[model samples]
Target: MRYIVLFLHLILFSIGNAQQLAGHVYDKNTQKPIEGANVYLDGTTLGTMTNKDGYFAITAKNKMPNALVFSFIGYETITVEDPFSYDKNFKVLMKEDLIGLEEVVIGSPLFSRKKMLAAFKGQFLGTSKSASSCKILNENDIVLHYDPDNHVLSASAENPLRIVNNYLDYDIIFDLSDFGVKYNFNTLEPL
Candidate 1:
C-alpha cells in the first residue's frame, strides 16, 4: 500500500514540475514571422528552433522562474524573463541590428589587398591549435576594409565565408551579413 502511494505521488510531482512554453517569433520592424530563430531556456540545454510559421514549443522540466533566449543571425538577441509566469502562449519580437556595417575605410590611404589579408589572417583564423590547420578556400570572395578614425575592421563577402578546420575536423560556412572587428587607432591593436 505504501509503494502504491509513493508511485502516485511521484507521478503527480513530475506532472506539476513540467512546463510547456509555446511562442512565435516575429520581426519587430516588418511584423513578419522569423523562421529558424533559436529558442532556448536560459542556462539550460533545452532548446528548439522556430518552424516555418515561426512557432516553437519547448518542454521545460524546471518550474522555477527562468528566461528564454531567442537568437538569430543578423538580428538582436531577445530574452524573455520569468517565462513560466506567463500563460502557455506568448510572442517574441526580435529587431534587426542596423549598427553593424558591411564595409569600412581606413584613413586616406587604403590598406592594399595583401596588407589586409595579412592583418586579418591571424585574427580571423586564430592562432590556436585548431586554427593552425584552417584554410579559407575562396579568398577572392572576401572584401576587407579598415577605418582608421574609428579603428574598426569590417568585412563583407560576395558569398559565404568558407573555411576548413583540419584540427577540429569541421567545415564552416559563415554568412557575413554584418561583421566587424574593433581595434585601437593609436596602437593599431585589437580591442
Candidate 2:
C-alpha cells in the first residue's frame, strides 16, 4: 500500500510539472496568418517557428517562462511577458515595418557609405590572419545608418550577404535579422 501511494505521488508530480504552450501568429492589419515567424522563450534556446498555418507549440518543464519573444525580418519584434498568465491558445499580432532604409539611417558627420563599409568589413571579417583572405561578394547589398542622438550605428541587408572565406575554404551566406553597435558620443569609441 505504501509503495502504491508513493508511485501515485510521483506520477502526479510529473504530470503537474509538465506544461505545453501553443499559439498562432497573424498580421495585425491583414488579420491573416504569418508563417515562419520565430517564437522563443527569452534568454533561452527553447524556440519554434510558425508553420504554414501560423501555428506553433512548445513544451516547458517545472516553471512558466518570464517572457516569450517573437521576431521576423521586416516586422516589429513582440515580447509577451508572463506568458503563462494568458490563455493556452493565444493569438499574436505582428506589425509590418515597410520602410527599412529610413529605419536604419547613419547620421554621423564623420561616417559615409564608403566609411561604413570599410568599418563593417574590418569588424565583421575580423582582423585575424585568416580573415584577411575573407571577402564580401555582395557588399552593396548592405545598408548602414548611424543615429546621432543615440550614438548608434545600425546595419541591415536587402538580401542575404554572401562571403568567400578563402582562408577557411568556405563560402558563407548570411541572412541578417538585426545588427547594431552603440558608440560613445564624445570618444567615438564602440560601446
RMSD of each: 8.0, 8.1
What's the residue-level lDDT of 18 in candidate 1? 87
Tens-place lDDT per residue, model 2, 81-167, is 988777879799999978633453335465777876766666666678899899889888887766677877778886999989887
- Where is the poorest 10-residue window by lDDT in model 2? 100-109
State in Å the error of residue 96, model 1. Answer: 0.8
Task: After superposing candidate 1 on the true structure, give the runs of residues whose Cα lies further than 4 Å from its correct spot.
Answer: 1-9, 102-140, 144-191
lDDT of 1 by residue, 1-191 (tens): 99999999999998898889998999999989999999998888889999998999999776756688899998999888988888879788899987655545445645677777766777777777878889999888888777767877767786998999888899989876666778766323444
Pick by lDDT: which candidate is best? 1
Model 1, position 121, has a per-residue lDDT of 70
Question: In candidate 2, how many Å is residue 79 off?
Answer: 0.8
Clashes (candidate 1): 1
In terms of TM-score, which candidate is strongest? Answer: 1
In model 2, which residue pairs have backbone atoms overlapping below 3 Å? 105-145, 105-146, 106-145, 106-146
- What residue pairs clash in candidate 1, if any at all? 106-146
